[model samples]
Target chain A: MIKVERLVKAFGRQQVLRGLDLDVATGSITVVIGRSGGGKSVLLRHLIGLLRPDAGRVLVDGADVTRLHGRALDEVRRRYGVVFQGGALFDSMTCAGNVAFPLREKLRLRAAEVATRVEAALTQVGLEGMGSKYPAEVSGGMRKRVAIARALVTEPEIVFFDEPTTGLDPILVNTIHHLILELHRKLRFTAVMVSHEIPEIFEIADTVAMLHEGRIAEVGPPAVIQASPNPVVRQFIRGEPERAEGA
Target chain B: MTERPLPLTLRPLDAIGRWAIAVVEALGRFGTFLGQALGTILTPPFKFWAFVDRIHYIGYRSLLIILLTGGFTGMVLGLQVYFTLVRFGSEAYLGPAVALSLIRELGPVLAALMVTGRAGSALTAEIGIMRITEQIDALTVMALSPIRYLVAPSILAGLVTFPLMTALFDAVGIFGGYLVGVELLGLSQGTYFGEMQSFVDLSDIMTGFWKSLSFGVIVTWVCTYKGFTVGHGAEGVAKATTDAVVLSSVLILVWDYFMGTVLP
Candidate 1:
């Protein structure tokens, strides 16, 4: 379980989070949705210890991580796998090398065992047998799978996806959405996804938290979020009402 | 987290605050850089050849210019000293003067300065580009140390190349002086060779090699730091490449002075 308390972060004077709070239950898929620059990414960055809250604390299993550093912070980071908005795969490495990187570098595994895990993770992400290809040789959708494979290679307790579905066509987006859902079921990752794509994301997320005006406007199940009377929520949902209906 | 807003005072205090933040960020980068480099030694998924490639670029390929510059250096020194020696009816002293000068200081320092410009700048730009593109970050998340993978091999190459290049400079320079003194300055080969052999000392040769080894290390260190420290985008990379060469060259000169003062 993870808990956030009175989180406050500021860039100079532009306060992005003001006394914000949220919680994640074990094995739950929590999707954070918001407008652009609404600090959704900021909130996620804080969760992984990438960004320290200015005036609050992020507690993972009751441990305050706001002031953690060095090996302690790295241990916190190891608990979660982050897929950056840009995929952030090492370009110089081949697809398999990228996927196996954490295993080779961070985990102590036999070479043969590392190879086995890489193959398994790649197969899990539907990228089996494309090991030697570089990131450039693959399509955008394939790159995300590689990043996903990288995230899952270590079988992290949690996986944070930052704009995972961005820049993909509808079919590819759905494929990724399904991949996310299937990955959660198979790997049991506590998924934390941040996106501005409101409606369809809920299909994969167990719960939705609409980040607005620096705080979660509402947080609940998909059905509760669908019936929300909040005007900001209404406008965002209706703007993509057709997508939701199709979903 | 909600970040607090700052008022635009544009005051001296604000300037100081900005400077402090910048210093802290630089220190943070240095810590990351050192850790990554040291980490490479232990981390798995190592790329042995990538580091060797960097060294090859910085060391082996910069040879032609080192040779040409070193050859010309000895020739110029010989010509200048010949004229001075002639004024005192001692033209034969040109050989010993040129040999002593080349062996002690000019050979290693000048060759290293040139290599720093050529190879150091290239390495800095290449790594800076990698850094800006988040390639370095990608390496870290993979648990690979960028320093161990990229820096250690280059350091090794520098250690080997600097001494080798310095020897080339010393050899070419002395030979160039011999050509000018015996062929152009009207000094006999026997006289030139005798004076040169008599004056050259083991300590002088040792000083040059020490400077060469240290120079190689400095060139790579500065270049690697600049590349790794680049914070901005392409503009940051460009600035870092220029700074790498300029700072390393300046430091080489400073080291040369200290080596000269203390080594003898």
Candidate 2:
């Protein structure tokens, strides 16, 4: 559903994404695993048309989103839903309001119809009847669920999760991953998630891509990636630090 | 090869040059931001409800502060002008003096400054928080223009509210002057109002109107721009809010001076 070709991005003197290439299959959950600040979020931003690549192309459904802007870019983005690390739910809005936002903004649904979808979305995320509660009034786990509900309410063709499980407890992380898996099973949206959850991500990801030094070091199915011989991949999966020079 | 550093005498010049360049660059960015914001605001698919919500937030909510400030300012003017005029044996001119100051200059300038401290700061902090927390990004991914969703409405509200609030301030201030000059200071009620009626004209009211209208744009433009471009994190938001309020206040005063000089 998405293809990135030789994507290069830089911040001042620092080069973040250097000739990076990635492909996301339709109806597949692709979890991009990398070290913190390895341009994971930056790459995701490029895919979602939030960041313009210095030299590259991001093609979604055969159209290069990198070249799109204004109404064209917006048309492409209309099919996209993003979940930021902080949930990014509007604090002033209730959970239901947040979920209903995309629906109301994008679709010309009646209030009754919007409310019905919001209810279903909340319930789907196991937060039934919690729509009226403000984001601050909810727990961290509940907030993440609300964000997911908001993202999925529109039934987007593509959903990008930028560390949606970060800052959550291990149990909560597992719960979120399971919830994502359940949703994927039901809706089958093409998802590109940036996470560092290692083995936990492997369970839910149809394909796992390990990013190292601004490039994809390895990418394959979970079992294939687990058995890969690449030292960077092995070291990362094992959660080991780099060896000393000459060691 | 290693580069040589500038001498102490030249270092200050170098610093000054850099400062000048930075200021010019900032001005350029602000101009571009203003253009884009205006463009979005003028485009179709207008957010009528959002605009109305902001009108309430920026205009209606600011009523009490405008009233309080206007009243006190008029009262102070009445007191000071009475004392001054009494020395000249023209204490009856107190009403005209108070009315002219409030209507021509103080009304718009002070109202804008007050709104800057009140609504402007809040707007910056609100948008800055939204930026840092990724809500702005969320809006973008949802295919919504944050400028349209946020900036345009605020600017429109500012343009609408600034003049109205200034007028309110002027009215309240005139009344305040009446209370002080007529009731407290033993000035004749008819003479006080009668002198104001004779002295104040439509030209003076128009001056205040033009000044307030421009001040509205300055307040909303600077505050929204600061918030939209806030750096990052809580510290970034704090700095943006402080900068927004300070810059808006300064610009209001400066613009007031320019309008006072330029307008007939």
Candidate 3:
């Protein structure tokens, strides 16, 4: 389980996260949904230790990740896999090289073992026979798949996806969503994904956290969040103005 | 008595103070990054293969340009010096003049500037693109340090390659001078070669080596630091590349002048 308590983060004068608290249960897919630039990505960065919070403690499995540094922080990070919004696949590397990077860097696996794992991860992402292609040579969807493969190759205990479906068309979005579901079903790693693909993402989410301003306005199961009594939550989910404004 | 604002007429001073602070801050950041890169280089689990690859990239890849620059510079120096020396009845000294100037100054300075324009700009753009594209962040998340994986090899390669390139530049330049002064200008080959051999000293060659070494550090440091701290988006990458090349060129010249006064 991961616990975030009173997370406060500011960039210069702009306070992005203000006393935000969240709990991510073990082996659950917790999808954080918010408006663009509403600190969803910032929160995801903090969770992965990519950005430090100004004031907060992020406890991952009871260890305070924010307090850890150097080798200790690396030890914590080794348990994580992240798929950035842009895929972030190293352009210089082929798909196989990209997937094998973490294994080689962190584990020092033999060449043959690295190859086998790279191939298996590529196959898992439906990218078999495509390992030789560079990230630039691949389509956007294909690059994202390669990124996914790279993320999963390490068999991390936790995975963070940042806007995994941001720029995809509906068909591609559906494909990616299903792919996430399939991977979750197979590995059951704790997943925390920041996305704006509402209603669709709700299908895969075991819990939905709605961030408004810098705090969670509402959080629960999809059905419960769908029926939230909060006006702000309603305004956000409906993507419309409150009807009782005149009163 | 009514109080008067102390800086009402001192706005320029205030602006100057702010500018100084910003410059100092930038310098401190660069120093920190350099220290980090050097520390990573000195630590264990050294990536010798990566260093070798960067040497090829930063040095071997820059050979053609350096050669061309050196050759042209020497030819021009030889032609100009012959004409000027003839008026003073010192035409026999043209070889040493060309050889000495090339060895001590132009070879190291021009080669460094050329490499900065070629390899240094590329390095900056590559790192800046990696920064804006989140590749650096990806490395961090994978438990890799960008300084260790990216900066150290390039820095070490520059340090190792600059003096060697300056030597090559001096050789090629002197040959170009010989071709022009002896072959074309009708000066005896013996006289021209002998003059250069007698006049040029080991200390002059060592001075060129020192200058080129310092130029290498300045170029790589500015370029990599610009790339590593570049802002966001395509505009940021473009700006960083331009800034890296421009700043490194200026700093190389300034450092060369300072080293001229400091080194014998």
Q: What residue runs in model 2 are displaced by over 4 Å at the alpha carbon?
A: A244-247, B1-22
Q: Can you give the lDDT of residue A141 in candidate 2?
A: 95
Residue A90 error for model 2, in Å? Answer: 0.8
Model 2, A1-247: lDDT tens digits are 7999999999997999998999999999999998998999999989988889999999998999999988899998888888889999999899999999999988758899999999999999999988889999989999999999999999999999999999899999999999999999998899999999978999999999999999999999999999999999999999999889999
Top candidate on TM-score is: 2
In Å, residue B48's CA in model 2 sits off its true spot by 2.2
lDDT of 3: 0.90
Q: Write the per-residue lDDT of candidate 2 for residues B21-137, one digit (tens) a residue.
A: 999999999998889889998888899999999999888889999999999999998988899999999998988899999999999999999888889999999999999999999
**Ten consecutive residues with minimal summed lDDT in candidate 2 chain B?**
B249-258
- For all candidates in order, the CA lDDT equals 0.84, 0.93, 0.90
Cand. 3 TM to true fold: 0.95
Docking class of 2: high
Best candidate according to DockQ: 2
Hey, what RMSD does candidate 3 come out at? Answer: 3.0
Clash count, candidate 1: 16
Q: Candidate 1 on A73-188: residue-level lDDT in tens?
A: 66777777878777888776899998877887778678899999999999988988999999999999999999988888898998889989899988888898899899899889
- Assess each model's interface with DockQ, reporting 2 decimals per model: 0.28, 0.83, 0.79
DockQ result, candidate 1: 0.28
